[model samples]
Target: AQSVTQPDIHITVSEGASLELRCNYSYGATPYLFWYVQSPGQGLQLLLKYFSGDTLVQGIKGFEAEFKRSQSSFNLRKPSVHWSDAAEYFCAVGARASGGSYIPTFGRGTSLIVHP
Candidate 1:
């Protein structure tokens, strides 16, 4: 079984400061990793993903993540944070099923709080 873990429950950062959200996963095989953001009372939006090829992948909203096979981690990073970036970020790991469908296992999520 595969699982995702987000150690930080909450993080507060200055409005213009850089941000890094941690994500770790456990899986027997090569896992499909994803990062998603969710505004309050809104649905989750896909930020980035790593299926194969490049270990470093670019994401929307100035976000980027590097997949480290040695550490089994996919940490998200933003050069600068904004007020609008305040939201909940989730890390998920997906496993392929018999039908080739991906089954996602989501982490609890890290809440980003932006301050002036």
Candidate 2:
């Protein structure tokens, strides 16, 4: 089974400062990674994903991720964070289950605290 871990439980960043959230995965084959953000009482929104191709992939909301096969890491980064960006971020790994259905194993999640 593939699993992902977000080491930080809570990350605090000043408004307009750069931010990076760490994610590491354990899987036998090529892994599918995703970053999701959840605001209070809101559903998780896809921030980015990495399946194949270029190591650097861009996504909405000025976010990007780099897939590092050697290190088993797909870290999410943003040049500058806004106060509205404060939310819970999750790192998930996707794999096919026995029934040929795709499933995602998510991390514990990292809560972002933005300071003005």
Candidate 3:
């Protein structure tokens, strides 16, 4: 079975500060990892993903992530935080089911709080 874990439930950062949200996963094989952000009442928007190729992938909104197979981690980072960046972040792992379908399992999520 594959699972994603986000140890931090909530994180507070001062505006304009760098931010890093941690994510770890356990899967039988190489998994498709993703980072998504959700606004208060909006649907989730994918930030980035990793399937293969370069370990570091650039994403929208000045965000990027590095896929570390050794550590089973895909942590999201932002060079500078903004007030509008306050939202819920989720780490998900996608695995192929027996039916040949891609099933995504999401982490509990980490809330970002930006302080002025």
Q: Which parts of model 1 are misplaced by more than 4 Å?
A: none
Clash totals for all candidate models? 0, 0, 0
TM-score of each: 0.98, 0.95, 0.96
Instruction: Write model 3 residue lDDT over 1-116, tens digit each, in one string.
Output: 99999999999999999999999999999889999999999999999999899999999999999999999999999999999999999999999878877788999999999999
lDDT of 2 by residue, 1-116 (tens): 79898999999999999999999999888888899999999999999988899999999999999999999999999999999999999999999778876688999999999999
Instruction: Compute the lDDT for candidate 2.
Output: 0.94
lDDT of each: 0.96, 0.94, 0.97
Instruction: For candidate 1, report its TM-score.
Output: 0.98
For residue 21, model 2's alpha carbon misses the true position, in angstroms, by: 0.2
Candidate that would win on TM-score: 1
State how far residue 53 of model 2 sits from its true place (Å). Answer: 0.2
Prediction 3 global C-alpha lDDT = 0.97
Residue 11, model 3: Cα distance from true site in angstroms: 0.5
